[model samples]
Target: MPLLRPRDGSAGDAQIPATSAAEVAEHTCAAEAVFHSGVWSGLDPRERAAALLRLADLMERDADHLAALECADAGKPLRECVENDVPGAIESVRWFAEAVDKLTGQSFPAGPGVLALTEREPYGVVAAILPWNYPLAMAAWKIAPALAVGNSLVLKPADTTPRSVLHVEKLALEAGIPTGVLRVLPGTGAEAGEALARDPRIGALSFTGSTRTGRRILTAAAETNLKRVSLEMGGKSPQIIFADALVYGEDLISQTIESAFLTAGQNCTAGSRILVHTDIAEEFTRRFVAAASALVLGDPEDLDTDIGPVIGGGAATRMLAAVEEARAAGARVLLGGTEVPVVEGGHYVAPTVLDRVPAEARILREELFGPIVTIQTFTDEAEAIALANDTPYGLAASVWSAQIDRAIRVSRAVRAGVVSVNSYSEGDLTSPFGGWGESGFGGVEKSLRAFEQWTREKAIWVSLHG
Candidate 1:
């Protein structure tokens, strides 16, 4: 078992259980038993919804404690965990709890004396493999919908941050969800995640992580049970700014900074690529660098810190190396290109801004997963759209233009799942968040669409006998 260390590299008291492949099998079998037993899945939809609502209430009551656990495990800023992540998790639960009962199948016109109808049924057992970036919130995103729709879940928390999710299991149980309906296994992806993927008992698998890992999970699904697989993968998302949009000035710069550096830039939807119109590129870059440089970086527990450490030292190393690589390839480091030594072994990469990075540079092409943004210039609308759509990823993007027509046109032109005009947003709980290209596959998370991931629809037909 590996001790889970926070981003600061301090001694962490928590350690994830070393659940082996065989143990994973045992857990899956238990989940299968629970699914077939009809204790959870057989409940009335409203009953299940009520239990989920209770669970959400419990989470809200313990929000501060949950936030602390997540902060210690993920090295996220404490304020962010409390103000954003925990609340977001609670909202996901409440949203799904309210929705599962409202989820309805369709009725169709068949014939003069015939009837056709469809009803949705829960998948037998679901497995959700989570990423380390947003532990509590991501877990809730998958767990809430899957459980609310009446499925037994086998959750494999990320190896590096498993405590908060482990705590969630207790809360779920306390909230009247039956034993074995929700099981949390804390282990490495190789042993636990691979087991869940390969388990024939799993009716579906939902994963949020790297594109490479998503591919392997897809392969495992195909080779074994042919289970439904939903993947939300990597991205190199872009933020485009037209000269006219600069009129918003400081407000625009602030939003753009948050887009690039939130979660220390570990977000899959991070706007790491800045495609600014050449007409205002110089001014925008200057203001952007200044704002980014002024962002406060310190201990995750600090209330005033704007940026916390990256996940670990390895991430810090990679971020610094990418900055150097971009510099070597004719890019200028307009701001930070160094590490910030906060705590003794803290992994803090200073906020970095790379200007004029060549299109071919790795920093522009790969997902850095750190506090770094690359700037590039485009002259016309066509070129801007071309630059935004050039990446292999189509996860999320932002289009900024003072003209509503221009913003709408460019927003439609961008090849991403979610696009925001004049701001950065993934939309509220109503939006279906998923990517188009290598960024996602099979299905999406959030909104009513997510229910499809945990359910199977069956059509029924009846003919009147004369």
Candidate 2:
């Protein structure tokens, strides 16, 4: 049977059914025309802000429909879509809309006889590559800033979950964004994604996916036009459970389970690495396994289902292979180690936990990117920090302790971009989101910092004597 296509019908027009090379080329060409014509880039700040607000409103109004589509495409729980992803996307657009007018160029003190000011201008066009998990939310993370700063966007949604992005494009068009301003090419990364990165007309590229893929995009951008690249990539973040923590009781176990299993552990910021004090490692593992084992793996449309499937069959296979490899490397599988059958021919992996994971295992070094977590024991504060920073990723981390000072100290010691104290996976729209090392190069700030990323600074000097 032919693969299912995007609802926009752009696929059929290109003679490349669904997510084909031809569709990607056509979409890239269309986006280049939009940039050259200066439709979105020419809009004034007020007009741009209004258009963004309209898009937010449209997303809010159609939240249910979009959430349903996301559930179908990504296998995320309906509740997650309705309560988290859609709302998060809408809030992102709204935040950027409010920031449009607030984005200002820098002014410098000039000595005698001259006024020096720096003006900011848009990059003209952006290529946004979104991942399969949390497709709508990640797309918004790039789209909101790119559009708010007056740039046209060519979005390439992941092949496994491109339907929600097509919905986003439809909503943008309905929200008064000019034609061709926000075009989507639903194709594989090799064709459409590489094309967008290599296209000279695309002045910048913002991506959210794996670290390996981010490197490829960076190489492509450098080789083609030296376009700017912003990447939010893979993470093997740590959740430290110190012996002094009050929240480390039953509640901690529950919170950790939720964080590890949210979106079936598909989140780039998921606390997949558990660093427990050696004294408490055994108890923590027991409680964690109990909580994770109790989770219901079923249809995502059901509100009561705690854990749903990963994105696609390929994702599921990769996750399972990682588990087997960990087992082979002597990691103890405490709870789940295989796939769970679900209705509608869905792909579901059981919430899995590996205890006594050696530091040298591939599962500990690389991102598992599934509902699986590795538990490692640390003898002291120094050991904890070392274990946390052992992986190539440095996206986010969390520390749990009753003593605020120790928690603060440990949180500061971890080499991650964002650290949560006594909390797991809480991302505020006001804070900057990005990573260090192999995670990514830049951040997505809810404030003016995001707009600065999309703009070029031009120095202007005026003669005061004249």
Best by lDDT: 1
Worst 10-residue lDDT window, candidate 2: 7-16
lDDT of 2 by residue, 1-466 (tens): 1354432212233222354555656766777777678677777888888999999999888899999888877778888998889999999999988878887777778888888998888888777888888899888877888888888788888876787788889989999998888887777788778777788777778888988888898899889899888888888889998876635577788778777889899898899988888787777777788888888888788998877777667777888898898788888898888887776566788888888676677888788789989888888888888888888888899998898888889888888888998888656877777788888876564556777667778899988975
Candidate 2: residue 298 lDDT (0-100): 80
Compute the lDDT for candidate 2: 0.81
Q: CA lDDT of 296 in candidate 2?
A: 86
State how far residue 198 of model 1 sits from its true place (Å): 0.3
Q: What is the per-residue lDDT of model 1 for residues 363-424, given as tens digits with 9 covering 90 to 100?
A: 88788899999999999999999999998999999999989999999999999999999898
Candidate 1 collision pairs:
none
Question: Which residue pairs overlap in candidate 2's backbone?
Answer: 245-402
Error of 2 at 181 (Å): 1.0
lDDT agreement with native, every candidate: 0.90, 0.81
RMSD of candidate 1 to true structure, Å: 1.3
Q: What lDDT score is found at residue 144 in candidate 1?
A: 92
Estimated TM-score per prediction? 0.98, 0.93
